[model samples]
Target: MALLDTLHRWAGGFVGLVLALLGLTGAILVHRDAWIMLPHAGDAQIQSTHVLAATTERLMSNPETRPQSVTFANANLGLDRLDFGKGAGAYTEQAGTIVSQWQTQWARPELWLFDLHHHLLSGDTGETIIGIAGVAGLFFVITGTILWWRTRKTFAFRPLPKRLSRPAIVRHHRDLGIVAAPLLVLSLLTGATLVFRPISAVFLGPGAPATIDTALQAPKGPKVALADHLDWRRMIVTARARFPDAELRSLSLPRKESGLVTIRMKRPQEWLPNGRTTLWFAADDGRLIGARDAASLSNVVAAYNILYPLHAAKVGGLGYRLVMTLSGLTLGLLGTLSVWSFWFKRPRPVKVRRGVRP
Candidate 1:
């Protein structure tokens, strides 16, 4: 028991700051659409196929300014986003007027904050560190709960420590940790699973990862060069004709040697902000090559898809966003205070006079 307590304290001291940063950033990111103050950002989403097709055609008409991809407006944010690759992008109105353009993610708080929260700004290495921190945080929650059991009778709810003293902080930590354990578990597990796909097997069952990989594997066929002036409108119209119930979510140009344009959509039934229902078209002649209905995915894969929405509060509207915001804030508070208590609030060593008394 003592060893467990010591390990928890030490682990908290080591990874607490990282967890705090992730929590605070995640909280802010949950309201990204609300806080991003671009022109027409708050305008209501327009899902009319004519408007969508015209706007997409206009944007892609200019090869010089054409983005590699376009993420369509949703109910929360009315601006379409264009990704030009290499950290360059712009946001445009539904009518295809460019509102804001950036050469790099540094020019936008929302972009960099997302990058920081997801990758710690160090790419894959930082992502691995974040995954490690999430694992440590889970350990803290589980072991903290066990340790709290000993003093459960003395539990008192306090949002903050009544005072800065060690004992007070410890008590606050215990009570708050217990109060926020469930939320913390949900947030941490979903987050860690995103970075480490194999972990999904725990919640999604064995072979789940393999199943998802097989299902999502891109088509293998003879590759062709992308046509200079493919019919963007026709492609959009065709996709809409096929999935009349789904909202156009995103469209991506083929990458490298792959000659397929991918169109993604969100159905009303999907919890993922960008629903997995997808259509693939040959880039050379814009012929429909394949499609996948997200709703018809394997049960395990379907359950796996809900993790992002659950973690990021992408669904459930304002109420769920607020719930997730509270979870993030609570995690931040716990991590920040845990670090302080473990490092700065330690007991001071006692001194004795040399040979003065025995």
Candidate 2:
């Protein structure tokens, strides 16, 4: 009880409010990718490698925008995301019209939201403030647990008050806080991982994590002339023949002489945003070179990979995603209720008799 009160007191009014706001936003954003990935946007088949090559040629050869990067999207409404060096390009899955992109400092709405979540969308200051907020959240959760522990004997999840005389806001605050404490803790802890990555890296051994990043970012080895190409259809055929069970999510064409054509395939039973099998091809000759097994990643890298998808519930499918989203919202609500309870429902000081009380 002392710890809970102390933690609550230490949380202050404004900081707690901010954390709650962040949690609320994060809860909303948590399942966005899953929702966005659904068929709501528009239909465009994930183009074949040859077809993609031809499209690239056509788009580039067209009098308009030049191709910058091709982002292969998975599923329907998941037309490949093509980036042009110029700010104006097109999202084929989203109406096939040329769109000029804008973000806080990045180039997309998603990035803007992400920046808002982590950095309060203010760049470095937002990042630092949010990082501090996460650390504070961890503190509050631990202290709250310690306090909640002392009162376990009387703990009950009574969200609605039976008494008609009780104030509604205070009741709402207390009950909501009681029910959502666990979820708030979870949302905070998972989010903190992004800021404090080194906490888990200690277990991954020396230099192994850096190695994994390098491997995942392996270069497109030795680019050949774009004039003669295998094209998208054949490329897809070749990749399918090579890895039968893999789902093609992305394909990055080589940009330079040393570039390699990279095919990223989805992994089985994984929750984070990672593909177990990454097949690299000599961009010029379609030669298969090095492959990365996601299952075999160093503990540090694997841990990092699992965090985002788990945070967003993407790796866990619909049910898991729902659970995560609800958890975040619950936490936010709980945090808000907690502060309200403390602010409005604290016990009144004892009254003294008129004169001879001393």
Candidate 2: worst-modelled 10 consecutive residues by lDDT:
95-104
Candidate 2, position 303, lDDT: 64
Clashing pairs in model 1?
A: none
Among these predictions, the greatest lDDT belongs to: 1
**Number of backbone collisions per candidate:** 0, 17
Residue range with the least summed lDDT across 10 consecutive positions in model 1:
213-222
* Residues 1-358 of candidate 2: C-alpha lDDT, one tens digit per residue: 6656765665744477677778777877765554444233445555454554455444444434434555555542355566554333345543233333432235565555666787786767887777677778767666655655655675556555444332554355444555666766566666666666544444456664565556567744555654344444455566666665666665665555655666676666445543656777775566676777666776567766766666665655667667777776665765675566567665688888889565
Query: Which digits, one per residue and each the tens of the lDDT, describe model 1 over residues 1-358?
Result: 9999999999999899999999999999999999888889999999999999999999997777799999999999999999999899999999889999999999999999999999999999999999999988899999999999999999999999999999999899899999999999999999998898888888788898899888877776349887788899999999899999999999999988888999999888889998999999998889999998988888888888999999999988899999999999999998899889889999898777898773
Best by TM-score: 1
Give residue 188's lDDT in candidate 1 (0 to 100): 98
Q: Provide the lDDT at 354 for model 2.
A: 88
RMSD of each: 1.4, 5.7
